[model samples]
Target: MDSSQRIYWTAFYTKPRNEKKAAERLTSKGFEVYCPTRTVLKQWSDRKKKVTEPVFTSYIFAKVDETSRLEILKDTSIVSNVRWLGKPAIIQEKEITEIKSFLEDFPRSELAHGDFQAGNKVQIDSGALSGQSGVIRRTQGNKAFLIIASLGLELYAEISLNHLKKVG
Candidate 1:
């Protein structure tokens, strides 16, 4: 296959509340799709229900080549492929594995908005997240919570102070 036809993971934006539907359709068409979701206890005045919600509200990842991307886009539930620098945003395999492993370890972790001062980038020099760079969302004493944005989605991970260093 030509370079443009080479397979890679790309993030797609789905219509509101259609993340699951989009993923299911893509998978049925033979595209590998990843839609990480978590079950949470949602409560109301009269009852509590366990609801499975997308980790990244309206986004899903799919493995497809540029040649088949148009087919994916034609799915009614999918709005568009996420773009980075005017091209389809490609997700690294390692990053995908890292996110999967992270969710497995911390299934209920919530995504947080990072408010680090401008120009601050933190990299984990050691630990499970070693070599990963992210923005520090918050800190408590000797621990820090990081927000990593990859493939158009944001994920949160907590690490000890010593494992992190300001790089850029």
Candidate 2:
């Protein structure tokens, strides 16, 4: 296929609570769609049941070429493509594979919102300091400066914000 006809995995923002519907419609039209979801136990006033919901609220991914992208936007449930620098954000296949693998391993895992701020205690989730808890001294862009107390001394290190999770 030519470059214009090459398939790309692009993310789209959907109408509130319309992710599954959009995925269905797109698939029915012969477009490839992916909507990552998780099963959770939800409790109502008098009942509890397992419900599957989209992992990313109001978001779904579809594989489409440039020509079909216009057709995708015509769906009422799709608001618009997720954009970066005025262009549709293209998602890497490897990243999508990782997400699938992660969900398979931890089906009930919840996504944590990382709004790192100074003085918040967080635990390193990966890299050399994985599992170590530290207090954020400050944040700069995508990096967090942490003060890790160990062996009666405070050790300082800068870690990527992606590797840290807020600790309660």
Candidate 3:
């Protein structure tokens, strides 16, 4: 591929509960897709069962070149690619690797969310809180206090240190 056709990883927003479908469609169309999933055990009145679900709801990653950007956007399940400065957001390979490594270690860890705080800005790449951005208030052992801002509220959550990556 030429320079203009060099492939980059991009995050695409899917319709509600359509992350897997969107990934499948993108894959079937010969594009590399990533939608991390984990198995979680749930309890009910009768019994408990393990269910596999997407780590990041309404979002999936795709490896595509600039020339194929419009083609990938044609999928119905994909609402649009996540953008930065009016352009499609390009996710770094290192961030992707960190997310994969996190999933391998904490396949079933619960994700916590909260608002901003005073510390280094970070992003949760995997788990229930994938796609959330926050600040690291502190870290004790393997646990981190994350302050995530959402819906105009500052929320605080304690998460694993391994699940976080410094956001650029």
Q: Pick the candidate with the highest lDDT.
A: 2
Give the CA lDDT, 0 to 100, for residue 39 in model 1.
Answer: 64
- Residues 1-168 of candidate 1 have per-residue lDDT tens digits of 688889998899999999998898889989899999886655466765567889999999988898788889999998899999999999998988999998898765332222233335888889777888898776754467889887788988878656777884
Alpha carbon lDDT at 76, candidate 1: 95
C-alpha positional error of residue 25 in candidate 1 after TM-score superposition, expressed in Å: 1.5
Backbone clashes in model 2, listed as residue pairs: none
Give the worst 10-residue stretch by lDDT in candidate 3: 109-118
Worst 10 residues of 1 by lDDT: 109-118
lDDT of 3 at 128: 93
Quote the lDDT for 165 in model 1. Answer: 74
Q: Each model's TM-score, in the order given?
A: 0.63, 0.64, 0.61
- Roughly what TM-score does model 2 have, to 2 decimal places? 0.64
Give the poorly placed runs of model 2, Cα more than 4 Å off: 109-168
Q: Which stretches of candidate 1 lie over 4 Å from their true place?
A: 109-168
Model 1 gets an lDDT of 0.80
- Candidate 3, residues 61-104, lDDT tens digits: the string is 88889867778889999888899999899999888889999999
